[model samples]
Target: MNTTSQPSTADRAFNLSTWLVDRHVEEGRGDVVAIRCGGESHTYRDVLDHVERVATGLRAIGVRSEERVAMVMLDSVEFIATFLGALRIGAIPLLTNPLLPGRDLGVIIADSRARVLVISHERAASLDDIRAGASEIEHVITSDGWADFTASDEDGAAYDTWIDSPGFWLCTSGTTGMPKLAMHTHGDVKATFDTYATQVLGITANDRCFSVGPMFHAYGLGNSLTFPFAAGASTILEPTRPPTPQLVADIVTTEKPTLFFCIPTFLAALTNSDLPDDTFASVRYGVSAAESLPAETFTRFLERFGVTILDGIGSTEMLHIFVSNTPDAHRPGTTGRAVPGYEARVVDPDGNDVADDEPGQLVMRGESSASGYWCRSAQSRATFEGEWTRTGDLYTRSADGFLTYLGRSDDMLRVGGEWVSPAEVEGTLIEHASVLEAAVVGERDSSDIVRPIAFVIAAPGATVDDEELTAWCRDRLAGYKRPKRYEIVTELPKTATGKIQRYKLRR
Candidate 1:
């Protein structure tokens, strides 16, 4: 708990994965559980053992610190070991969602230019068709079902050759085009942990944490993996897809976690479940990120679970949460305030600061911001303007500094010279009794003009027509802000990390 005396590692540059190992040594938590995956548990000491073996194995396969290593596996102990092991020797570990289809995976593979691939046996077969044409990849390390491969003499030895540089590469969600790989230095990732975990989450050794988010994403990587590990806290890591309320309920019931991190959609689903009282009795703090959390879900989370849902805004570029609302300062719908060592501002189209209540593009410059995109000269130039990273999110800052997310900059709609935020319309629509979830997009009108159209997902067993929904929006929103049309569907499209894919709806 006494973080005051220890000198900051901020200036002492290091790779993210190796710094984690240093923390484990300093904290003397080698015997503590570091990862709990699919009912299997591994201690910090166990993680260290794997790191040595994998680092040696990778070296035996001719992988160097500057070399690229890609992993396509479910969230499990092996995944963590392989990732961190690559880091131990300064190898750049490129992580991607294993559930991605062949076409998407092929694009990422080409983009990453990875020479080595670490994947599970089950997912390995799916690459049979793709591997025929993949000449760049040399070694294919399988976790399961490959029993014939012989271990090298250096398999369990340490790889003493270490280079000091960034540790990983992650492809961004290319909603606009092919995804660009974001280069997160080991130092950047560690900075996120120090700022958010120590300064924002205020975690301690006794806190039991659990993350439903996928580890490949920034949120899960920092908070679920790095933060908890650095703080000496234990986390439950289950490998699953679209974790439903039923699955979450089971995890909460059995794990008895104190802190829970999830997205808004998953939280809404949990609140809608018929779970018994005290189902989340052990949970004292709940954190939501990856997507905007509706006020309705926040209220329901508190009312039913008796724990405040602290919503924060984070991105892959920022490494993790740079703005957060902790338990002490619970702003129901806002994205809270910026973290220490960081500054944020809302800017208009011309790059001038906007008024307190005016919505503008959210621009931030900080220590934890990414250096730049990998290999994309044009993107790096556009995204990195000096030290600032122009976050594409649109937001309005209140007088008290709480950030209200309007939507993504590309998500804003302009119709008849009036600008509108999809979040504002979606927020109003979800407040209606019949709507469960809502997404708003700009559609072409009969005049070939652009206008806001809302897609509504009705609550279970509730049947309300589009006419009624449009009227409801009209009563709650301004004439220009009201939805011109409505599309009723069972659910909205979402990314693997649970963020709404608004671009998909636009198509």
Candidate 2:
């Protein structure tokens, strides 16, 4: 990672949107590019304009500092503008996946108690049936105006003159229970860019950052949006799901992005797909997070694209990644050393620190740790032991402080009362020649005995029967830990942020 410090003047005040405004005026190089469908390009100035109008419209509609604003929209330019606009006026934006079932969305809306709801045009039309989904929401805004607003601005509500303090509220993708909104002050996001962009990414005015992840997640919000703006760089906004290899390759060819951020699955798909030779030629850095990077994915990415996929571990509560591996320091399977100013440790269930090379719950303490979660005092309190956040995910620390991700606390299975990490099983399974991707979940049998059921996604043009894959696991894993059954699948379900939703498989 680049650690060169550039001199910067301390702002007497800080706001997330103001960062973009400052860049648009003084440092924006104008050559930075982001590509969307049909290869549409957006300049820094254009993005600034959109954010300004959205902020103005929101202010006119009564949004203010610390107010909760719920957003249910796809990946689009409007999503970015509305999100930043909410932050501009100090309104906390709570983002949820638009694809969530109506019942789930209703539960989230009710739990968040958002004062305002912003929906994309397409989403608005589809959600008409659930009009009163958020009873607490007083104002409703849409990309294509549904009520009194229009896509085109008419009221000369001066947006540039409106000023306010900035704050944000976002939900954590909890493995269980309803998601909780994490409270963040205005300075939180700005501080994120300072640490990640200036210190880690080494972003520059000329760099074009391409984010293939959802902006609703912290990875997309900070790494893709806020960090790039901090460096006066540009971003391409695509209002869609994971860009197919053809579309991603096309975007790369058209935009010539300098920095790319995605997860291992997408990277694997890109490497396996029929992308053109020069598709990733201009990229200087590539980052992978949200899930552990498979060793094979790392090797394929480097061999095919000539760009090292720097993997990291981060949580929504921290705002962005706290630990990462750079190209030079990267050990393919490890999550790498902790970022500067952050400390991490592996602790047993009793909260005692464990020795190196031993697996335990990962705990972290850092400047970027969130203040608290909204309305969920009990859950929030459980997250900390003093100031250290108990990351429910399990991990192993090496002698050099490199962290290797295990599975979630809930996902870890027990065989004869002994803990069995699914990640260890899946990693070993994927190492088999016939396997491409694998997920393991506990299956209960007639005797109330829980054993692992492996779901394997085989490599294209490769054939592996379920019985054969089960035997392969038997050879690699311990007798008690080996999969009791195997199921072949085309693909596994994942969250918008690319995390495998193992709970979905449990059902």
Candidate 3:
């Protein structure tokens, strides 16, 4: 392993694809298992061979350096190979969710101006609609046709000579508005591996990693692909859309992973499922991100299983989790202190630092932070100010350096002239025994005053009345923080990453 400090930018240039993919082959660890998917496994050498062949194929098709290649596929070996392959040949890969609506996908493809698109057969039917608007896409390839394109034995450019250029592009979750592509560099990739994965998470070659989030999302890209590759660790990929608890349990039993990456919604489902207590007995770490883990969900997960989840906060711009909880030093309700090499602060609207325990917007600076949003100059200027990126997230920092999420600044509701954090109200609602999940949003009343309204999913076989839930909240929460009305629903609308779409509820 290269234990030496990272080379100074002025002294040497490096490509992230070469650093992550070629290093294993160079170190003679090619025989080790690198990826496990669909009951099959591939060694590091196999991955490299595939990557080189794909790079050759891309080059043969006139994919020049810095050209954009977008991938709308599942979390499978093909996706991994294509992503690294594009980077290996000096092309920028755009990681996109395949399940996006056709209109949204067209908008993103048009904005990115991607030259080639790799999608699954199931999604190929939407190409006509997407291409009508995204005229720049010159070629489209499906997973079934991947082998035909990469059937050559042509050698790709040597890793040593690969251009040290920008890394893959990731779009924001679009929780606030239309998603923008965030441009990340190779330096940002290495920084995330060094600070978050190696220093904070302590991932090593012996640890088997499994991720529940889709690889298209930044959280999954780092947790499942980049971090494991950096450590020469094995990663398990479940290609099933909306993986069920039984599938996750089966993978845990078969793969025997030491590390598990997940989100709060999945954690809640697993906790409520009939899985045995020992399902996670072999697991060493349970990491949660992408959204705040409700305190009730955290407690329930710990009680149902013997593992404690390390909840953290990260953004697409940051590449990976910069503020996280180490397994040894975790606080249940708070996202732990900042990971090494990163700094965080809570500041008011005026950009002044707020006092401890005061709610304010979270602004962070780190080595892994992205350069800026691609092609969105105005948004980039508003978000990236000098060294810090304005997160638009509302949080409170304790004197002890722990961070507690309140809600998004725009998601906060003014009820009776007092600001109410929807997260707080939803957390309180989830604490009730009959509530499985809850989302709080602001609704205007007859007098044009905003009030808190809750949408809840009841526990299985547990009948919950709106009046009962309102009374339950009244008992535990203050007058202003309690929801004014409750609506029982079978499920809440969620993003692909499992975060509740609060905006949909407001509409």
Candidate 4:
């Protein structure tokens, strides 16, 4: 394939956007429906046209190849177009959760040194605050104002980027409000599509896919955008943040998707809903990730909806799921074997493989692994050791190679499928004038899912109002990271070194 001109099957250079969006149009799939969102349908040709215009628009705004374009927009047609358009010209799109507060978003933008940012309309008010700290951001555009960036001539020169050039960056697994940014190459995108998406999903052009996970997340990126476009299939995108069960039911009933992607919390919500069993009749396979799926939830969903949920584990470092349960090898309790192109191993602290049934760190290596965290040399070295990337989750693999999750190796809690750092939460709690000290720990809720609970000691002569404290944290932390219940205790158990005994708090 030639890199200097339009990408084709005969070209030597590989660009993920061309392969995902433009190639479909060039390969006689122009008329095929590519995406369905907000009561609007776009064909491969239509999406490609938007991609071209966005690419030209970026160039007109002086965005060069390899520069980072930050996106804090929800799932929509504008998002797909801008993301692919940035890729079409070799500009890397940095994905940040749209729901994150301005403080957290500022950390990501400052760390990434992104000069361009695209946000949804609802986030416009935070623009002044977001731009204050991140001086690197020179231009900010709203999601709906994408057409304003376009030029009269949509034709633009595609950058001659190497296959291994950085294509995108994903912000994830942060211990602080700020976290590590995982940078993936263009090859990583296609590698995931060719490996996990094809082998595990068995996706075809005839299928329509929908996901409850947000598109900014790695799980949703693969489910709603990457796999569908690469396989010439159609995708159903939900613009509403945390779409209600009724909304999902409506889409499934009307759009008739063959594949459904979801997380554990949303799956449980749907299972507990009063929606008819046949609501999911059109779905062939359901995919779950971002957190370990409970067996009871899996059983209830399948029995109620008649859709088999394939549970898997993936990370921002690896791009997408590397270990998954397939229809042929079904396991409700355990995360199935390694994907065809990936390898998984449970290793001790010494980096040697551990025996089956012995809980150890889960490490994996695959074609989709990111280059490393941007500007985080220590963490990148700790995570990406030679070939394997440490997942930071403790698990036990059976002799037959089925992996079962135990818990996080660190004090981090997987609440609602998002990592919540106890240290971060505790720090936020103590910031309140009413709290002299605070210790946060994860406890199983009534649903048998993990959530954070905090033990706080009020300052001398200070009042601790649960409602007032809750509102304080609400203003400071992200929604998921906030403690669910605050325990106003007179004292907290501590070690001889004066360290807060988180284990005691857990009990």
**Top model by lDDT, which number?**
3
lDDT score of model 3?
Answer: 0.87
Error of 3 at 335 (Å): 1.4
lDDT of 3 by residue, 345-460 (tens): 99999999999999999999997778898999998999999999998889999998999999988999888878899888888888888988889999999999888989988886
TM-score, prediction 1: 0.93
Better of 1 and 3 by lDDT: 3
Candidate 1 weakest lDDT stretch, 10 residues: 155-164
Best candidate, TM-score: 3
Q: lDDT of all the models against the reference?
A: 0.79, 0.75, 0.87, 0.82
Candidate 2 residue-wise lDDT, 135-250, digit = tens: 67677787777334423453322223222233666667745546777776666666666665666677887788887887877788875677777677677666766568787787
Model 1 lDDT tens row, 1-507: 766774444545455555566568556778887777677778878777777677777877888867888888877777787888788777888988788765577667767778888886667765864454445777888887322232445654333432226768876765554567888766676677678788877888777788888888788887567888777778788887767788888988988888899998788777777887578899888899988888988998789889888899888888888887876786888899988777888998888999999989888887777778888889888777888888899999999889999999988999789889888888888777787888999999779988998888887778868888778777888888888778888888877878788888999
Per-residue error (Å), model 1, residue 265? 1.1
- What RMSD does model 1 have? 4.3
After superposing candidate 3, which stretches have Cα over 4 Å from the reference?
A: 1-10, 158-164
Cα deviation of 206 in candidate 4 (Å)?
0.8
